[model samples]
Target chain A: MSFLGGVDTSNGVVLDPECSLIGESVRGRILCFPFGIGSTVGSYAMYQLKLNKVAPRAIINRSAEAIVATGAIMSEIPMVDNVDTSLIKSGDRVVVDAANGTVEIRDVTERHVVTSILRNRGRVLILKRSDKVGSYRGSWAGVSGFVEKDEGDEEAARREIVEETRFTNARLSRRVPARGFRHNDSVWTVHPFLFDVSSRDVSIDWEHEAYAWILPGELKDYTTVPGLGAVMNDLLSRTSP
Target chain B: MHLTKDEEHVLAGEEGAARQKAMELLVSLGDIYGAERLIPVKSAQVSGASFKTIGDAGIQWLEDMSEGTRASVPSMVNPLGLDMRRWRSMGVSPDFHGKQARIVAAYRSMGLLPVYSCTPYLAGYRPRRGQHLAWAESSATVFANSYIGARTNREGGPSALASAIIGKSPEYGLHLDENRLPKVEVNLPSVPEGLVPLAGYTAGKVAGNRIPLISGQAFAEDEHKSFGAAMAATGAVSMYVSKGTVGHVRSRGIDRSMIEERVTISSRDLRRCAEELSGDDEWDLVAIGCPHSSTRELAHMARKLKNRRPRRNCDVWFCTSRMVHSRCPQHIATLRRFGKVLCDTCMVVAPIEEMYARTATNSGKAMVYLPTLGRQTASFRTTDQLLEAISR
Candidate 1:
């Protein structure tokens, strides 16, 4: 959002070397990004884009920050936020209904998966996936598996915990709605769960190689799955009391 | 969100195109922040007035928006990149001045007052207690909300302009009484001479987005200007309440039980901040008045320098609003011996990087921007220290 350095208003290209969309032209295209960063004057940069006839046709963001929102309104550009921006691609045609605050991506599919966390006392269990697993092999993750068709999220969570950790006596403490993440072409809608167990002991199966009981603060030290720490924090903190 | 019939008509594009666009901006922002309705504001202070900051694209947008738009309330503009009368002497090229003049013309055509100062409250547009405003300049918004006992969210430039055109803003954030209550208590030991801005800078980092209740020091109105300017520069919150009699809080129905964080800023901490902010002493430019100098500040500097002779070794600028500049002509004449008494511009938004490599300023807000926006190696000094350095 550096109006002075990051954008070339005349050509509608992102000139910022640090920007992910460097050299990309926003002209007549629906621009989708997480949110704007940098100066408040970045709002003016957006207006500049419109003046040059290089402004984005529409804007979609994960969340609406004030700067970009102000810019879009001032420039008369249609915009919507609180959308899963990862489901959008560069060439994907986006229809932004700012009045309803929704964005629809023309061609993309969403897949749902259940990721369950097993907690014993104060520590949560982290399992390393086996190489024989479908995706993210050798990566540390929560007890996870794809949701079977027609299965409830909680029922799927219980099944995954029993199959991955062999903990049949685990009680479901908390369950949160699914969150989406973009991986290659498919959108992973991870339904998170926190289960309390009586013991730290676990029986590993063919899907996992090793397991460890680590404090939640130490989740950053290990290379786990995407959004694992966030999912764990949300589930654990909500059910703490 | 609920909209009245008139508001709905404007949103539905029943009104003229400009007013409809303004209504749409307000309505969408209201939706984003979950504001229940739009409230009328007494005034607005719009930023992004400078050509150096906004550039060619800004000129184009302003020209387009100016076609049919006019301010519904009393609105003032922020500082431009150069003094309108003295651009030739300030080292601003003709090309930049031409672009800047177009911006000024556009704003003037839109019915904005030509008080190109960040301290619009000081320059005749002061709002009363309990009045709501849609001010954009961070320093002015903080001053209006905290010191003047007004209500306003820190608005962006275009939103504030929209508010000016329609005379209404989204009722959210600081406009709500519940959000005005102090969530953190900041205790300060006696702030050293010329370190008040640093204390504010430190307080901002400690408070983050929470409204801080400051205790243990009495500050004058001018000190509040510098302190609050620095606080808003570093922190996300627009208002802070001091414990002293000055700028007292009207905590009518607020619950004080939510305060969980208490921070103490000691003399050692201030010293550390000063040491960390102090850069090289040798500077090509020594500029002051980041929030724009008040009349009293101009007179004080004039009194101090009236007896001393100018060294004239390096460039010096005494930045202030034209209104204040007009009020202190004798002071301006005396200070002009030392350096240029610049108006409608300060070191932060000016194109100082193209002219000077190193700069020194006393303002904590300037210390944050001079390095990044001005692209100069910055040196932090007190006003007295900077004045003494630039004088014989």
Candidate 2:
């Protein structure tokens, strides 16, 4: 069993007001919480970041936020979900390979790929990755996993969805393969999938302490799983309900 | 791709620096927008005409780019300021003066009208949604697209002029019909009561960039203008929310009767709006003039204070076009008795937090309430609400 890292879900994530400035400062690629905090104007800041051509290429989060997701979509920034957030800090050398839904955490030396996507509607999702197994463990994540030895990428993707969302019939839309690229020291691929669900349909799994459909712009209220914000931002951008 | 005889002549350098640069700029801009040829402008608005925030280099670049197309049509403008005199008072330099003069000279040659206010729509230059126009107001873009269904991109000053002189803009981004569709669905708890700035503030923060098709319990047409203003102010974004009748409003569900009630200017509504907005919070700044308040609005302010003394600690400002500023220098003494009246300026281009700690506004438009102006914590309300907040 492989687990990545852990994130604090005791209180909701509180987003930084200057997050937009941070997002705009990164010229090429950056990793952050999937969703932004509650402020619809934050959505505009994201778009402005894109309009000014100053947004990151991709993002990594433990959960995905709808507002950030919408911004990423409108701005056309690539993103991925499900990373071991406890293991990463604000300025850590982490690579979000949105092409493979895996985050390559490279701090000084050791590097590994963790798969996940930040999602929001009813509540943000956070999962604990198993560090002993692979990359993340005891770390809170959104949705994450790796391909099974025999299962195809799409089948593995579906299985991961079931494991994360607890919905056997997620009704996967289109499965896009490797929508991004490899990170600093790892080779991984991502399969972007859109699952149809509303704020009322989601239920929590033990892997996460709690779940609630956070308002779109206020994803920053939750602080534990910062990675979830980045993932939510990316998925929201790519997936349209 | 297809240049007119005059355009060809300008392209061939028959025009002087102002004319040549104008033509070259237009052609380059046209190529970017995929415009087949230059079209005539109904009007245009210039940015950095007085070098408010940008550098002299930006002004010089505009001059160099707009070289040859001086034979352009009549147009409107956003102000550089009343005269070069205000420039030094505002800490503007001589280099800035040279660039501005060059632009002013070019605009004079092209016969561009220098009204110098962002609220051209307020000054009788409303471009119906989807109409090809060269407007330069960012809030105006949000107002036109979200409230009026017009299409434009807050591309920049030069592009706006080019579009006006050529009477065409690049047909991409918001200009495309298909792109205007709402991406998010918002359902509000209730239409905000008078001075509930958060209602419009929430809407703007929630749907800054996307086309938001919202049906809120509290949303009334009167508040739409505040929402639109907030949306435009927060970010470089626009919105599309519905108002029952007027399309946009300064209050909640203000019916025709209320407008009739307000038609006779008693300054009562203004006082009411201000009262409703009175409250204490850690504010970033207090912003006035969502569309650059009209002279009549300023006159009302003067009239209101005819009997009262000026209040201290509050940095109140009245924004207006350059033309309006020039037309009423005498009015300045009256207004100064109450507060500062900044001409050829709006909060849209000027810094909000730079002057105050938080912001408050009375417009129902989202463009002004959104993040680029102040954080989500910024307060909002009707003009009446603002008055209340300030008085308390």
Candidate 3:
């Protein structure tokens, strides 16, 4: 944002007609955005907002770039980045720990899940969830299920693969660390595992309607769950030469 | 980020609040960029100095920062919104002049040099080859890294100030030798006269974030200045390596194996760029020197305008550093007949939007900034074209 033209420093209102928050005021609240764009002069504009006592108390970003980071530091406003900003709502009460580089949404709970990719003959299995499943119904996913309260991530991954696919001869090839995604009030921490199965045949449970074996690149054509492509690519690339 | 014991102490606020804040900024930036440690810097050149750019909020912040902190290394500032001594005569309002004075006073208390030109290297703070500096001005940063062979990441104002106060910057980006290698190869077939800046502009668009190794041409010092300034403005890169000619022989360091992409810009391409950038002829102001004019540029302009008479149809400005202006009294006198010989200010940083709507310039950097920062309908012309329009 060209701070000189885009922002009204006196009122804390974004003035740029092209800006999404054109009519919104960034005053006395925790402002969450992807990142700042435009000139370096935006730093001084942020300071001007602080001098007017209309600056945001804190700022949360998906990733912090230089311009906004400099502005936040100079203005002494608390800022934290590398946050999944989609989890945060308009009225969500957020706490920013700038020193630790962490942000917490007060009312949100984190849920851990295990999504295991079963590979047979260089093709990964894609399972389409039935309407009976709790979330992501009628969506394509890997062999996925919630992690039980006492189970380890690997144990959860193995258990889910067996329960969902009914494959007993599956041998684990690789296991990646957990990755997180925001779905409403819960952040789904997905633990992905790659398993090489001796057979392509699978018996589907009531949770899934059908299953298909697809190459990693073909995963893009289907409407799969969020971060499914990333999970498959990570596991496949690591296991490849 | 790995901090030394002293740095950790500063981070822990064992030092004063000002140092603690500066340290915090450096550490946070270091963490963001995955820097392992901080390295000492030789000097710093900071931007965001103009009151027109920073506004009242910047004035307050600087005034507050000046209370306890001081620059540990020699630091020079970018151009201000008005000339320090002759602001009133330059048509700057008293309100802006007052705010600018407060900013100047704040930086003065913090031990920053009052050389408010963008050409800090030309203003007696030239960094030697391989010296690490935390420079904010895009033009100067590119010049320092690519021309002078110094080391620096293109820093923001607050971060550069932080480095100035601490005399250290996070070791990352351009500071590391491994990161300095050129990734793209730009082959230029002889840049024509009055087209070097446009060539640089095109080269910047081709290079993007990667450093481009330019081949097939060797440029003079002033030519390199304009070229690098335009390149930095048009691209995110801080440096470009030109092949051929250094000192008594051809300098080596172009690794062909390292180049990922190769691009060639011809004279026809530069002409197309000029055609695309060319705007209408009617202008309210014709401002020169985006990266302030050097002494040689001043003398060259003076020689061109010595036989011509000013038309006085529109207001014109010849912006240059105070050092260059002082060195060329005769040139300054000759140039002043055509326009105001402004020192310590340029079109980009000054509040030209309040005064003029349509502007013309010979700088590629000004072409990029005039429409946005200056709020002027910009027309790009060659130096001869602009001089002809202003004179006769």
Candidate 4:
């Protein structure tokens, strides 16, 4: 959000008509937006908010621009950027630790899940989750499950792969850092792993009703779970190196 | 962005809160732009000083920063909303004058020079060739890069102020050698005598964000001033390579392989632009300078109206910097017979909307701003035309 003419300093009301939170007061609130996109005088307008005692308690941006950064420092407002602002919604209680560069949603719980992509030949395996599954029913996903308290990410990935696909001779090919997605009150942090197998044979478990072994390019034809496409792209981009 | 030990110390607040905040601002900007480090700046010219533009928040911010900080470099300010010494004569309210005074006091306490004009290159703070500056005024940034071979990105008001306090700017954008190359070529047609600024206005529209290598006509120094100001206003670029300043661009190593994109700005386009901005002749005020007039422009304008008598047809504002105004007393006196020779402010920065609704200006830059910022039905005219309009 821009401060200059885009917001009213007197009451902290977002004046930009294009903004989603238009007419909503930002005073004493933790304001989250994409980034500032207006005049450099926006910095001064933000300072005016502080002078008028109508400033937000803290600011969270997907990315910070020069105008908002300058205003945040000049006005002594706590600002943290490079956050996934789409996770934050109105009325969500959030705590911003500016110095530590972290944001915490007070009421939201983070769930860790292990998703392993089993590759045989040039085809990647995708499973259609059964209706009996507790979450993401009738949706396509990789060999995914929850991580137990005693297991590391890799151990959980191997365990989920064996339980879901009955594959024991899969070799670890690639692993990347976990990526997070927000869904309702839960933050799903998915740890993705790629495993190369010698055979495409698998005994299906009750967790899935159907299975498909398809090329990575054809994965988009099916409806998959959230962020599954991105996970596949990330894992497959460095398969050779 | 990597900060040196000394820079880290400043950012760590060992240098005090004001300096720490200034360093923090610089570091943030450096990180955002993906710069390796901060480089020392020769000078800084900060904008957003006017009360009309900044209002109470800017004054308060300056007051807060002024408590324990001073400018490390020779910093100059953009024009205030009114002439600091003669706002009463310009029909400014006392409340506005009070706010403007506080802003002036805040800047003065911070050791910033009150050279309150956008054309600081003409007002005694001209940078040397190849010198780095943190200038926030669009016109001055354009002029410094295009005319004097100086390097500066078009900085924001607060970023420029932070650079003034820290005496350093992020080494990115125009500060780097590779970013200065002209990406587009603009071939100008035979521009009329009075349509130089309009030619610039047209060229800027075609240039967009790319720096244009302007060919065709040779422009005087004043022409560069007017041309670049208009370009900076219309386009996102702060620099251009014209016939006169091509030497500066060549010194930075021209890359012809990157100049595949080209655009042509014709005289007919400039004439059309002039016609579109040329509103009714019945104006409430006629303003001369947008990027404060230099001594030569003042002399030229004064010479044009030396023998002509004032018709008292409309309110007139001959804007120039205070330094230039003091230097050209004879020209000032002659122009005063026609209108108020205002110093430290111009028609664009002033609260003209409060006094005049339909304004006329000779500046192409003012043509972009007078209608929106000044809230006036603006009429575009040349220097000769504006002078002729004010004087019989």
Candidate 5:
């Protein structure tokens, strides 16, 4: 048997008509597919699962969303990411070893290559984004986007920086391996490569309105992704040579 | 920052396991922020509940890892009120119980007051800006650092409690009064006329993440609660909720109809402002009791519901202090029949997943709305108006 655990990491409520069935079927089941979506307030619901002692024993994710990951980490639930959710189904018994960050399905069909990006920052080559992309369309961001078929994840990230920001001569740092998660058809990878751009190399893409060389303290002006901000904060704190 | 001799000793394993663990965590955090020396803190307001209760092991690990050193700061805590009897009946796992007991034991041993609500300000732990406090209320943090001008980082539960125990937090961000300066400023046209709660919500939307020094309104103290609740609701991270009332309006016999009309427009403007300020959905949780609902408000809820009947499937909880709860147990059945009357805890303070309300509405216009604090983001409106929404 295979199971698809419908986990929501929102701080708000995800009201579904078939909530009871999903809740029961998914418990102790192979948590499957996609990063939990919906309201950030759903974070509280995740908390409630622990309070009532009915939380999913383990989580299988395309990628860990910020609130969910933070909440799960804070709550200490086992979770594993980067595994294809398609192999798991509506009813499957599974044991999730979150401490080691792995998952074992009772009867799995196939496996896919799952990579996670460990992003580090020195001078995050920020791109002044334009309105072409939806969401934060005309804002600043680090090298970000999805890894297309055949193209390497690193190439895609660097290409995205160039395509979005029009930077060409900056040196590419080591590729921080990461995964891409599609929560409800939105597929983006977890890996972001770090690069150091010279003063002359810094330029704004039509995608972004402007760019800045900001320290961790100054990065607050531009709203980067939530967990990413915390990550950058950690990097900023590390002792440098 | 230099660790106190006591803190240093803890770091070196002079103290027992709990203190060692807690201090080690603090030192790492301090090193990250470049805090040279640790300072003492008077009080701390902590957030986050037990791993057992929250059911997420990741959260549990984070809690345990951060709780390494039992810092010696006076602290205020959010309620993790677990009815163990109820859990046993549900056949809850023992692992969950053990994790929760560890946290509870830690707090109790530290002499931390486990009030368990996010709105410590209501519980009388208001730390004015620059007051040398260690707090973990997200909305309260925003309110204190931005509005009240208190200093704090968005420190998580363990560090926040530790700082309160040791009486010091890293002097960064809001701690440096200069960082608390208002980057964005908003001005209101006039006081709300009708359903002041709606007007307060409007103010929250307009003031998101910006410092709003309000003008042009006169409100009773109860009304101020409404405004604060609404501001926090609409996502104004911080606010200087001052009296904008002009004496002439009341003295000259201001027409009630005119005031109501302005209040309506103000509420709409608030929604518009919130949309403009926020990036994502701009959605948040609507919470009441920033300072906790005043005793008079609780009394009013009890009296009103005293003669009324409960709406089917509608949960109207009245959160207040224990002092207020003791005054009206006889009305408990009536209140529960309609809604829950929770004491020493409010929706924003305690985890309300069981309440099953994704979005909550309240009445007021000061700075009560804090979606993040509620653990569920929110939308704000006045109490009477919200009652209509909930009923519908």
Candidate 6:
């Protein structure tokens, strides 16, 4: 978001055609966006909004650029960035801890789940989640399960691999950065791990009805769980040193 | 980013909120750019001074900042939207001057020098070779980094202000020696007479964001000024390494392997740039001085127009800094006969769209900005050509 020519300072209304919140007012509400663009004078336009008593109560950005950060500081508005702005919906009750650099979205629950890919001779294992599963039933995924509060993420990943696929000899290869996916009121933070196995002999568990060993390129053809394809590519792109 | 105990205290808000805020901005920028630590700066030249650019929002922000803080270092400001003394004569309205006055006052109260020109290097307070600075004016930043061997990234208005209050800037980008090495080589093998700005203009287009090693021709000081100004305007780059003009920087052993891209700007290309940017012959105003005229430029223009008579075909403004204006009284007087010798402002930052729809200038930088920012159908001309067009 930009303030100069991108927003109306007098009424606290967004005028930028490129913005998602066009025609909506930023007054007295928390503003969440990816980042700012346009002139440096946009910084002062933000201050103008503050003087008009119509500035955002707080601001959140996926990444803070100089323009918005300067404006936020000058307006004395609380700001926190380095956030997943896509998870935040308009009208969502959001709390920003600018000092601590944390954001809390009210009514949004978070779930931590681990998913592991078992590779044998370059072919990867993808399981079809059974209807009995609570979420994303019938979606294709890797050996996955919830991460227990007492368990470390990697420990949970190894445990899920053994229990769900019945593979004990799979050696841990690599782990990619965790990603969050929003569904309903829940934010599923998925931890992805890759493991190398000696055999393609894995027994199916109760959580999945079917399993298939397919090329990494074919993962996109199947209806998979959210961000599974992305995590799979990330996991497979690098070899463990 | 590594901060000293006092810097940490400022960031932690142990200092006043204003200083803390300034520190926060500096530290945040430092973190963003991956600076190891903050480095003390010699001075700061801040942009976003013009009321036509900043408007009411800028005024209020400066006022708010002024109440709690003052410049910790020697800081100079960019141009205002109007000349304080001659606004009415320049056809500026009372309402515009009133707002412009507030902006000047806000900056003044914050202990900023009311230099009100982009050419702070020319108006004194020139940064020495190897000295660090935080300057917001793109043209001056280029001049400082390339011509003077001063280290600085092209800072934004608020960032430069933060540096002014903190007396420090985050060491990154052009502030570092490695980043100053030219990635692209721009060879202006042969430039035509009166086409230095266009040479820079074409070179900027070819160079893009990379630093260009400008070679194949030597440039005078004033020639370098207009060249660097146009380059910074058309390109994302703020610094250029002119072959021989880099002074002490030539000793840094610039690796030939670093020049990954080599582009030769032909004399034909510069002529094309001029022809294209020239647009329509009819113009509402003919304005000069984008980086603000140096004393030499004012004297040269005065000499050319001294023997001629005003054509009175259209309005003409020879824009320069008050410092430069004060230095050459006879030149100012002679130029004033042909047109207004506007001080403290240039065509790029002024509210020219309100009174003029079509404009003509000798500045290649103005050709880049006037169409979009000033809302004018901009035309390009050589300084001699413009002088001849305005006077007989």
Model 6 local distance difference test score: 0.88
For residues A149-189, write the lDDT of model 5, one tens digit per residue: 78876577567756655666556544433433332233343
RMSD in Å for all candidates: 3.6, 13.1, 2.8, 3.8, 15.1, 2.9
Q: Fraction of native Cα contacts kept in each candidate? A: 0.81, 0.00, 0.71, 0.97, 0.03, 0.71
The residue ranges of model 4 lying beyond 4 angstroms of the native Cα positions read A113-130, A136-179, A190-241, B1-6, B205-208, B246-253
Scoring only the A-chain of each prediction against the true A-chain gives TM-scores of 0.88, 0.38, 0.89, 0.90, 0.46, 0.90
Off by over 4 Å in 2: A1-241, B1-41, B46-52, B71-73, B79-110, B185-198, B214-225, B239-241, B244-287, B299-303, B312-315, B322-334, B347-392
- Please tell me what DockQ candidate 2 reaches: 0.04
Model 3 misplaced regions, further than 4 Å: A1-8, A13-25, A215-223, A238-241, B244-251
Candidate whose lDDT is highest:
4
Q: Count the backbone clashes (under 3 Å) in each candidate.
A: 0, 167, 1, 0, 111, 0
Q: Locate the minimum summed-lDDT window of 10 residues in model 6 chain A.
A: A232-241
DockQ winner between 2 and 6, please give it. Answer: 6
User: Would you list the clashing residue pairs of candidate 6?
Assistant: none
Candidate 3, residue A209: Cα displacement in angstroms equals 2.7
- Interface RMSD for each candidate model? 1.5, 12.8, 1.1, 0.8, 7.3, 1.2
Query: Where is model 2 chain A poorest over a 10-residue stretch in terms of lDDT?
Result: A1-10
**Model 4: how far residue A90 lies from native, Å:** 2.5
Candidate 1 vs 5: which has more DockQ: 1
Candidate 1 lDDT at B365 equals 88
10 residues in a row with least lDDT, candidate 5 chain A: A111-120
Q: Each prediction's TM-score against the native?
A: 0.88, 0.49, 0.93, 0.87, 0.49, 0.91
In candidate 4, the residue pairs with backbone N, CA or C atoms under 3 Å apart (3 or more residues apart, or in different chains) clash, namely none
